[model samples]
Target: MIRKRKHVISIGISATFLGIFFFFITLNNVHTDTYDIARFSTAGETIRSPITIENEQETERKTRETVQSVPDRFNISTEITQERVNYIEEVFDAIATLESEELGEKENEDDKETNGDRLVPLSNQEKVNRLKQILSEPITESLENETLIQLIISPQDDREAGRKLFVENLETVLNNGVRTENIQSAISEINQSIKYATLNEELKQPLTELSKFAVVENSFFDVEQTQEARKEAASNVDPVVIRAGEVIVQEGQTITNEIYEELNLVGLLDGQRNFFPAIGLALLIFLICSMIGYELYLLMKENKLEKGKLISIIGISILIISVLKLVSLFLTSENQIFYIVPIATGAFLLKLLINERVAIIFTALFSIISGIIFNGEIAGSLNIEAVIYFFFSQLAALTFLTNVKDRTSILKSGFGVMVVNIITILLFVFLTFEKYDLIDLLIQTSFGIISAFLSVVLTIGLLPFFETVLGVLTDIKLLQLSNPNQPLLKKLLTETPGTYHHSVMVANISETACEAVGANGLLARVGAYYHDIGKTVRPQYFIENQMSNRNPHDFIDPKESAKIIISHPYDGAKQLKKYKLPKEIIDIAEQHHGTSLLKFFYYKEKEKEKEREEVGQIDESIFRYPGPKPQTKEAAIICICDSVEAAVRSLNEPTEDKIEEIVAAIINDRMTDGQLDESPLTLKELKIINRTICGTLKGIFHSRIQYPLKEAK
Candidate 1:
């Protein structure tokens, strides 16, 4: 139920954050301004489009023009050309038939009279009528009476020659597509061909007249093809779009109908409902928050999620977004004000206070959000330049801020960010091809330089507040605590020098061992330094601090000595809590002993009880330190190192072999004693830890060269 409550609260917090983000993003997008101006009225101020939209009216007009510009498509009919040629052939064939009919009548009449008297030939006028009857109606109607008569009276060879010339020329003229406008010109060309042909002059007139009948408009209008051509032209016409930031009207200029329509098209005019930008902003905020929430879920599953880190993420995100929005107010096309925003500050803080992965994820989110927020010219339009600038700036910080332990590292990284920012700015400037003055160039580069420094400054300032207020122990905090001059550390050094020295040694061993097993080595080291702080409560009771070669436990009762030994862990925990150190540090102080029995006191008491025949009365729990056990890999590692360091220090002659043997034995004893049961350390990690500790101890206790009389010299 408690876990469920945490999830619910976390979800609620995430929802609240998303709501706030949506509100901020929508501030610029959602407009409530009323434009009282009307069409063809003078404008009070220049109006730019708030949103990008297609001018459907203008687009349709352009499409109409484009479609009209396409000429009508027509198909030339080959069948018509062949039919015209056949008509000319029929006229000549009819003339030849008249001659043949006249010759056949002459032969029959000669047979009847027994004399070759000339038979009555068909007259030219009679032949003309007969020819008209034999030919098609279109051919007969097109030719004149005198033209047909002339062709009938002409020699048959002249008629044949005229027919061949007219048919060939007619076919050529008809084959070349003739529309209604060009049909007369085509007929004239065919007539000229007939006039120039090697035909009898009298027949040429008839053939020229025949050419008129042969050439009628062979090419006709094709409605389907014309419609298809227009459709293709319309499809090619691009939509007319009035882009965001485009000037709809200039100040002191008349607002014409076109300009007013454009204003209405882009949703700048009053009564135009535009909810798309707000909807888009809401969706963007939702997506960003969902990703962050998922990251938090992963952290929670890994037991790495703390209230402090969660608050840090929320706080840093809010700070970055608020900064962007505030700066966006100053941002303009003439001035790239977004360049001066300390966007990398969020990346630095997240990396230092929380973790790098979260920093990277939020950096990209910040960059994207910055792009939209810094779009000063218009709402719902992206400034790709801003996105590229912020991303590289933060990415540079993430890349170079490598040593979180060093306080100056953030500043050092700022230099890298500065270089990258300047380069990114220069890239924009050069790529734009627009002329920029020297002052403008300097000012833009200065923004990049200012951004880097500002990020460093803000990150440095915010870190202590988060570390102190949230009770979070970061690497920098650990580094500071490791200083010997720190209050608790100094106290340990001045009051219990022997134990202090032992702590330093244990810290070294624990750090190495923890790192070997992929655990937080710095955390283990810092924890180790404070783990023996409990021993400082009664320093003389601990063997290392009994420097006078005397033991305080010698005079005390075995039960009292055991109680004093066990109380130290809790005593150190109390002092640490009093100082309000982070929970992890206090945990190490409290759990390093891990409920292990004080064997010396326990055995001593057992001996006394055995002598008195009261061994059964002695309880093992009385001699054990009260512990919750080491609950983390670092805490578990500190526990083993703490015992191993103390055990090795007590050895009369510590050697490489002896150190290795004792390290392995101590780790084995801790495992068997179940001191590490609660920790997440695996058997494989334990083996690795064992080897690391042995190597570290062996290095520390390696054989030293003995000097003879040279020492006195």
Candidate 2:
């Protein structure tokens, strides 16, 4: 176990190192200078114009100027000036003085004229015209243009006051003796100015006040516009470009510092050279090693030195695969060529040296390793196209033809590989590189097909060497063993007729039992045939061989008799090993008897002991066979069949009902005693096994009657 663990740890470390090494090496080999050429296809192609810093600044300035040109109604300054205050006061004083004088005159006229009366209201149009004339009669000619004016009087009062003021101003102006046309023009100009001044002041005052409190001093030169200009400038700058299908360097291009820098900038350079490829190579090696380890585990499961053998197998297989990979590399710079050779070699080796399933699995793994190695050159980087081509080609080659017994199937498989490879390559090309030129596509397609055919041919050629070197008993070898004409089975049939007959019956019972419970029936049947061959060593000592002789147990002590009976399972195991049988067959031989007691001998000993002393010491366990128990259902079923067959042969008369009762009793005894616990057979499956055993026994042990000729006598 310790050795096995150490081997596993070693393989794990090796695989890890290999994967990292290959990754770096592949990364280093990648051409960084080619990227720029690949990005930009042709020399004469014109690039887009770039935006300069000056241009951006000019655009920003223009945007600011446009925002500033929007018109506004007010100036923030002079809205609350001393000139405006003075103008308001002067207008108020003038109106007050004019009202006082008019009122005084009216009061005097009223006193003289006998009766006082209220003034009549004027029409709105007349009042408005009169108010316009009054405002034109400038008592506030010194007022600033920026003064705020508001007419606070009621409409009726405003009209009346305006009319009175206008008449007074007209009398004053006429008294100055101005010409009529000049006066009219002057009045019209004054009226227009007054109206405009009043409205302008009203509009300007509020805007001026609002402007003082506004948060932004200027609405021009916004943040959003500035950012947009910067983005536009950046976008207009030219991007680095590259083009496809251009080799920037030749095969012998020097590994210079400039090239290294460029590769590093593009994240393609590896500091440690050769590491990436080595790591990739190591993964393939490790996988092969693991497969060998698993096979060894299967082979050595029943041996005492299982762990040691398993480790040795893994180590040896790794060394072999690595050597093969290295040799292929020396032969071809193209990894695809190397990949084809190893997989073909591995598959053929596995078919002959190991089982076909193991061979198929190894082939699959090799194909994947090939794809990794050939990716950049054959299929362009570690892509699905390369993987698919490798997988389908390998699968077609392995599964299309069977029985690598001769060179014919190998040739047939090579043809099948070509067909499959071509199809796979076409599929990959169509999916990945949509534009297909007939000539280039066909050449690449042919390469894949030819590689697959070569792989099959090479695999076929290597099979015999692997088989001879490894001493592997493959499925094909086992199949050959099954032939009736084999020397070993022929010898057994001739020399030990009764044992051969017993073996045949045991095979039937074991196969049926295995099948009923979904175990390997063929293996079970084969194992049962070889399980009791050890009995041939002392054939006369066994009851089946001593057919017409006296019983051998008559003169023996019951304890000694039981000991001989129990030793048969161990003896059978030893004989099977001498013949170089598989561990599975030996296991069935050793466990068929389990730890069952020889009841007749045990009871006889018990009765004799009771007569000899008041209470004698007795070891009941001595009567039972030594056992590791039946680990498989087939072995357990064979045990039952062996007992039932022997028991029924001794019966004078047998019936179907009687046979069933005896079979049920024996099965129930086994279940109660935990004899069948190790076997995975459930209660339901056991019932089926029991019924099959009884039915078979009944057929073999059917009743036969002796005929009497009394009438002729």
Candidate 3:
């Protein structure tokens, strides 16, 4: 069932990793500019990149601006055409009025012959000459002699018809608005209309000449207005975007230098989803899994592997990996130095939750993977620089984390990482032989130190979340629980003062013994303090809390007394669980005494059995505490410390020899009863534990010089 549950969790977590991988790979895999406008690269040819490329934001902006600048189209204005027709009719009217005045003068010439004072009237030839002179400047500018003559004079018999034909033919020419390029076509149309008109040959010829002058370019192109209209149109145009996986140069198309450069820009010159990226991704996953697996194997060899610890390790690793990938999405040419990424963060978190050895593994993992994430923008994925920088920072952090015991120690570790990061950055700059500018060198190196500092900051902020959510009993958590202000400890101190004092002494002994065996000393200390909490329920019933001369056990039956004493470990476990104390503390309460017998009460029962004259022997099992022997090294140490402290404190005058003897005796008793059999501790460690306990006890009970007391002060 446990193995199956692990598989289920693995599957669930792997699915999340796959999702992150998809997002990470797809984000940088952009394929742009696939259109084949010019006959370029062949469909079968492999395209090669000419240069490194990045998104052309500026080019895109310009293209969009040009598109927005497209001008609105205009048609020829009918108003200009109509105004030209009205002016042409006015020219003919001036000719007709002159002709009519001349005819009237000729008819009145006979009547005015006698008077001889009348104004002289011009002849037909003279009138024509006058009309030609009147229209010369404007007509000469546009036409030669024949067209100008037709505008100045109309034939007498067909004067109105000629004017009408001229107007109608001019309308036909102007109707289909003319521009400079098509002005000749309008001229041909005008001549055809005049040729087909019903008029005399003389009138028709003048009207045809007038048609040539009728049409001029009315629809002039406006450069400024045209540009404005184009801008408005271009403003509404969407960006001509190219998606990833688009074919930039199609197979069998001839490749151009421009196309090659475009392909290079999007990293698509070689093909879709380059194999190196995939291989790099795979290598990263395999390396991380393999290294972590080896660590777990080593832990398993020592019987120290816990599933919860393994899960937390994997979860923290994925978290840092995801964060690095997320940060990479923001990387651009202006910010190629991904020093903002706190590469040491995973190392710090791992060092806190796991150990330095595992943290070193994480350092390598985070650095290598981060290099992979930054491959294109930086030097390359799995860059030597990244490895060197991260390794130095992480190694330094792990150094400070060697025996980390509190939150302040992590801050100390951060300073250590920063110092190492500074040194690494300086060394890197030196190795490059000043290829980089002084400003860039200082900025990048500063960012390296900042990465270290920020990693520490993030670690501190996230520590509580991991501890609370994952139920990880880190040294800091154990230290927090060891405080006197803890509610459970406070209750034990006030309600069962004797038991509390006993617990404190036991804590001192457990810390010493556990430290000697390379076990969790803080955990043992905290656990020892909270172990006897059940005594608070009926403090006076326990011998330690019985200050009065009379004993509560004297009133109770022997079996009942044994029951009360055995119930404390179990009852304390219940209270710890209800208060949501760490399992390690609760385990100490549950299993510290294991199933050891309450011999005093059992013997007292035997004596009562004799007094009652009972034949059956008193059951030995009935007097024993419920058994589930010490399951952890820390719990076993607490058990030994709890028994040794109580017995040695009972000594009338404890010497070093007596403390040694008492410590050995209690350990031997525990081993004989098989209480230590299930624990991971061996006889070798137990011997060391014995010496440590003995030394601690001697210090507590050491002889002091006697002094006579003053009568009063």
Candidate 4:
């Protein structure tokens, strides 16, 4: 028993781990990257944010432009400014000596030879062109002859003196910062300084032009200053905050590049995988398994479950979950019609094969799992339509499939669940308030109906497999065993017809009493049908099948008769095992009589011993049927039922009181004989069993009305 229990628990834990593994594999597969088609999505389609997004790039752009202003960079070339004044001074000195140098040359031979190119003593204006060509700027053709003649003799030739005067007045005034627009203003400032300088009139004009050249733009664009300003500007600007539920794009709006990027940022696009969703899924799986474990624990505590039955439940759940996963394979977020999955199949099967309460709980869990599985576009997000449709339809199936013992009942329940699914889908659509076309509604409703029929089909197809593989003794199996045409039953009837009739009577008595005491009445009835099969092996030896008054025990030793009687239970059990009957039926054949003594044969032996005047204590084992005792309530009830029926049949005029007395005596004997001790029936249950047995027996053996004697014709 301990080993069996350990194996059961080990199988349960393995099932839990297998469930976890399948869920994990499915979840990982479910986390499909949303299609990477970065196209403009229109508003009519529903869009969900698959991940949490923030404004990283937007915040960076906004914050980077808040820089403040700084002073401009200046490039002051003092040497270049000083060189300008000296070049002007040298030009003036060259001009003043030019006339004398020409007079001294006096038309020399080299001058005569090069007369075409250099013999002419040009005008002061021509020298002005010469001077203007020597200097590209600060000299022009429009200068006055007086200004040019003064420019030739000016004595600001001392380099330090000329540079200091240009710096103190004209240069300082011109250097304010010369730009294109400000060039004339800088020239005017230099002229004003020239008008006030302590220099010759000839030097003033030339000095003013030289100082104008000295002025260059002192302040220029500073990158450091501009960057600082931009930084300040960016800092002063507010960050673009994106809240958790912020709408990146709304329905019916065209998805622009920016919005598409926003969707990607939020993981709503096929950009990347997020771990949090997997974590949440794992937690959900944990909770689901925990709930299943607790329910199984309760079932074990109630002593209502077996290891094979638990494995059967797990097998069905996995089958249905696999179906859900298969259905999920074709789904996309755009295709939210996941309501078409036949979730009620599992619920109906569990309710019928195992139980309804567990089915209902599993329905809720299965709906949630399907919701996640079919919630394709939104990734880990729930598909409300799937959840509502599955939950309501499964609930409907479980509620209606109870006591469904016929094909018509199954069809009726299937149709009922289909209707419920349709209603649920319609109600869900209404609650969502989304506009749907007529074709869309029709298609959805059609799938919902198909889902219901499909579930029923799966249940029907899988029922036989469960029964055969798990050794489950459902009502249908029991009813089939109860049929009069079964091989063992047919043989029993042919070879031992009286025992067959007596067995039927016991079936009637036991089935009713078993039901009244909350035992499996079908099992009891089916067991009673085959319980006395051993009598067929030696029909003449057993009293029920014997047609003659003379008994076989009359010629045999009393001990041999006792052995023959005691061997029947073992023979019946062996025959049942040979026929591969279910353990329940075999147990009934083996244990219904328990260790009860063959008192008639055993007393017969005692009588012979007394006749020889050698009576001694008879070995009780020789007179008793080999038994492990009645191990279940149904077996114990069958023992009482068989005894009551036989006792009632023997009475001359059986009444309610006589039936009660016989039933009470049978129950008391079984109890005193330790036949029912192994069964878990309480004292109160035994009393209830006695009352039920007596009531049934009284009805079967009720007194009949006496009639006037008529002549036999």
- Candidate with best lDDT: 1
TM-score of each: 0.75, 0.54, 0.63, 0.66
What's model 2's lDDT at 409?
71
lDDT tens readout by residue for model 4, 26-109: 575345345453567575554545544557887775565333233344444556555544555555555545644645665563
Ranking by lDDT: 1, 3, 4, 2
Off by over 4 Å in 1: 1-8, 11-19, 22-27, 30-48, 69-232, 247-276, 377-380, 577-580, 653-661, 704-713
Show where candidate 4 strays beyond 4 Å: 1-4, 7-11, 29-49, 52-279, 301-303, 377-380, 615-617, 711-713
Highest TM-score: give the candidate number: 1
**Better candidate by TM-score, 1 or 4:** 1
Q: In angstroms, give how far residue 51 of model 1 lies from its true place.
A: 3.3
Q: What does the lDDT read for residue 284 in candidate 4?
A: 80
Model 1: lDDT equals 0.84
Give the Å error, residue 390, model 3.
2.2
Q: Taking the tens digit of each residue's C-alpha lDDT, what string does model 1 give over 310-371?
A: 77888888889889888888766678888999999999999988789988998998888877
Quality of model 3 by C-alpha lDDT: 0.73
State which candidate, 2 or 3, has the greater lDDT: 3
**Each prediction's number of clashing residue pairs:** 0, 18, 28, 16
Per-candidate Cα lDDT values, in order, are 0.84, 0.55, 0.73, 0.73
